[model samples]
Target: MGSVQHLPYSVSNHCPLLVNKESNRSSLRDQRFYFEAWWTLDDSFEGTLTDIWESSSAPLVEKLKIVQIGLKKWARDLKFNKGDKKRRLTKELEILLMDDMDEETLKIHLNIEIDKDEVYWEQRARTNWL
Candidate 1:
């Protein structure tokens, strides 16, 4: 059983219609891997990379495939909500500034800004590539 609905124009100009079916949705495994810029901000990313590289003794292409699989798992475990984190950090910074300066808040705010820069550059690079 399946259903279809017309999605909002704001959803995407290219994909304004939604096809609802158990099999209509593409499996995540079918998707290509693209390394995200903000992934470097995660503490576990380095460990995941090191583990993947060390554990894989296969040839270059096979090793790359392993890396891709490992990274996808890492991404799943990340559970990062960038938008919510940014909003929370921004609010915390505002509150801290209202009373007195806080070093920790400043540090967190700076880190988020760097993450935003990474995303911006990544998008720009993708657009240029296209």
Candidate 2:
């Protein structure tokens, strides 16, 4: 008997094997159902601390001070490569000092005064008066 040969969809009168009408309709319906389900869920999301800080009633200068303090603490605690230790330390110190000045400027702008003696006394107490 001669070997059977399959004809291309265009040449064949029968519907193409790849084109399954039922499966396509079901897939589209499933996608639409999932989209509608997701849309029905709650849209509200909680704001993070940074978001709240940025939107806070606090003055811009105070916000900048808080950011500076955070940056300084990050720099102080970060680990640097041994080879670049000195350079990293120098850069960190310079940046931290600049941030400190920015924080002080913010304090001045806010008219929030700090007592140096009181701060010193507190530090002394923390160190057991040593």
Candidate 3:
């Protein structure tokens, strides 16, 4: 009888090391890309705000008061957004559990769906450009 070779799944197609290396490189690239894009976008927005403030005829105190009010509103909105997300996740988890799903499975699903929304502000912050 001829002996059969049992090739590993990864080796049968390609090297495992190469696959891991590519994945790591892609992840790093994505991180760097997002960081740079975020920084540039932030700088542009700040510059625009500074220009507007510098050119405004409003008194300094009035401008400051307006900015303070805006900031407070922004902070409140951020808190509300976070709370809403948490509530949604909790509701979904409860439904899943009520359907006899395991805790771990529910957690994984909730985390994946809820985590994507954590960056909502980065996009919403641009609306302040006016």
Candidate 4:
């Protein structure tokens, strides 16, 4: 007999999945800074965050705003230097290709960055990874 294939979205455990959706119906709200998961990857992410939080003598809300400002600047600077490592790897690959040297490591690094970029854009586009 041919093996059974599970259909897409089929659940084997016979349990229905319940998803809770957040509604944005609150028309009146206090302004707040939005933090993103990618911000944690920034250089000095933890240090800057801790420094701003610790040094702030303002109210909690003001401290939050200060931290947000610091993080925004840090993220901006990080953005400018983004892809430096990948660019370096690409340059090395070019040299290797020219000299016909081993490029396995460079190719691996490029592949990893490509994967990261793919995921980054996919999340940005709100596409399902599955």
What TM-score do all the candidates reach, one by one?
0.52, 0.20, 0.26, 0.50
lDDT of 4 at 62: 91
Tens digit per residue, CA lDDT, model 2, 100-130: 7444443432221123234434554666556
How would you encode candidate 1's per-residue C-alpha lDDT over 1-130 as one tens digit per residue?
5668877676456757788776533565368687777677766789889999899799999999999999988876554565666667777777877878765956676686667667758775786675
lDDT of 1: 0.74
Show model 4 residue runs off by greater than 4 Å.
Answer: 1-32, 92-119, 128-130
Compare the candidates by TM-score and give the number of the best one: 1
- Candidate 3 vs 4: which has more lDDT: 4
* Higher-scoring candidate on TM-score, 1 or 2: 1
Candidate 3 per-residue lDDT over residues 26-89, each given as its tens digit: 5565434122122222223465445556655678988765554544444445446656756777
Question: What shift in Å separates residue 26 of candidate 2 from its native position after superposition?
Answer: 75
Tell me each candidate's RMSD, in Å, in order. Answer: 11.8, 22.4, 19.6, 15.0
Ranking by lDDT: 1, 4, 3, 2
lDDT of 1 at 66: 95
| lDDT tens digits, residue span 35-78, model 4 | 65565544467887898789879998898888888877776676
Q: What is residue 106's positional error in candidate 2, in angstroms?
A: 41
Report lDDT per candidate: 0.74, 0.41, 0.52, 0.70
Q: In candidate 2, what residue range of length 10 has the lowest lDDT sum?
A: 33-42
